[model samples]
Target: MNRLSRVSIAAFALAAGAALTGCVVAPVGPYYGEPVVTAPPPPQVEAVPVAPYPGWLWIGGYWTWQANRHVWVGGHWAAPRPGWRYVPHRWDPGPRGWREAPGRWERR
Candidate 1:
């Protein structure tokens, strides 16, 4: 086979594999079916009281669940060990539900 034909065949194989792998979803972009927005659960209150921590900040709470398909992990408040800053949590949406992504801190 010529190089061009071989390349075309390889590309076709890759596209077929991607389809079989369930990587392609029906209609790209966020789902637009009436927006099933469930309010996120409030952050869990920290059980451990502060002794003398100054930089500790509330990371906020999150909603979590357990099942065979996927698990929902809620957000939490992170106590700054010493130098790290607290990054507030943010939300992202999907077909199943919303996801809370963890925040990061930058050094000053």
Candidate 2:
């Protein structure tokens, strides 16, 4: 077989193996929803307390938009999810205005 044919066969084999494995890779990005009229206040400096239980993770405090204003949510300890990671709530300044994203657990 020619070099081009060998390369094409190798690529096909790799693709087939990946398909059989059912593995998929995709780019994850923040979801931009409606813009808030005002920006959120700066995050508070939190002194994370010790975990009440072993293997627990600290979820930091963040500013949340509520009732047309910013509200401070205290930090707390949460039991770790087996195959997921915690996403802290945050606000991002977009072209239109500040956008708020709520905390969530996403697959690792």
Candidate 3:
């Protein structure tokens, strides 16, 4: 092939490969609408002890999916971030299954 034809073919192949890979890798977070049928067990109430240090916030415990079952993760103290509040993780029931919303820091 001529130089121009070879370059054009290479560029087209690269673009096509990127497009296909993007579709396969696009969903990075928890898979929604996955069939679970049964809801995860209720979260266990963990006693929030006194903060170990000043400006520490108590993040509550939550149930996490593991080995097709719900597992309890204990709560712990986290250093407070300026102008931000920590939101605790939670599992919400949906028609198909429970969706886990991970905890994150949000600006006040």
Q: Which candidate is the best by lDDT?
A: 2
Q: lDDT for each of the candidates?
A: 0.55, 0.84, 0.78
| Candidate 1 Cα outliers beyond 4 Å, as residue runs | 1-39, 44-48, 52-54, 68-84, 93-96
Ten-residue stretch with the least lDDT total in model 3: 24-33
Query: Which ranking of candidates, highest lDDT first?
Result: 2, 3, 1
What's the lDDT of the predicted structure labeled candidate 1?
A: 0.55
Model 3 agreement with the true structure over 1-108: per-residue lDDT tens digits: 799999999999999998888564443543534545567677787778999999898888887765666678898999989999888787677776667777889999
Put down candidate 1 lDDT per residue, 29-80, tens digits, no spaces: 3322323356455555545555345655655444433221223454444666
CA displacement after TM-score superposition, residue 13 of candidate 1 (Å): 43
Clashing pairs in 3: none
Deviation (Å) of 96 in candidate 1: 6.7
Residue lDDT tens for model 2, 9-76:
99999999988897778676434466876888778999888789999999998877665667899999
Highest TM-score, which number? Answer: 2
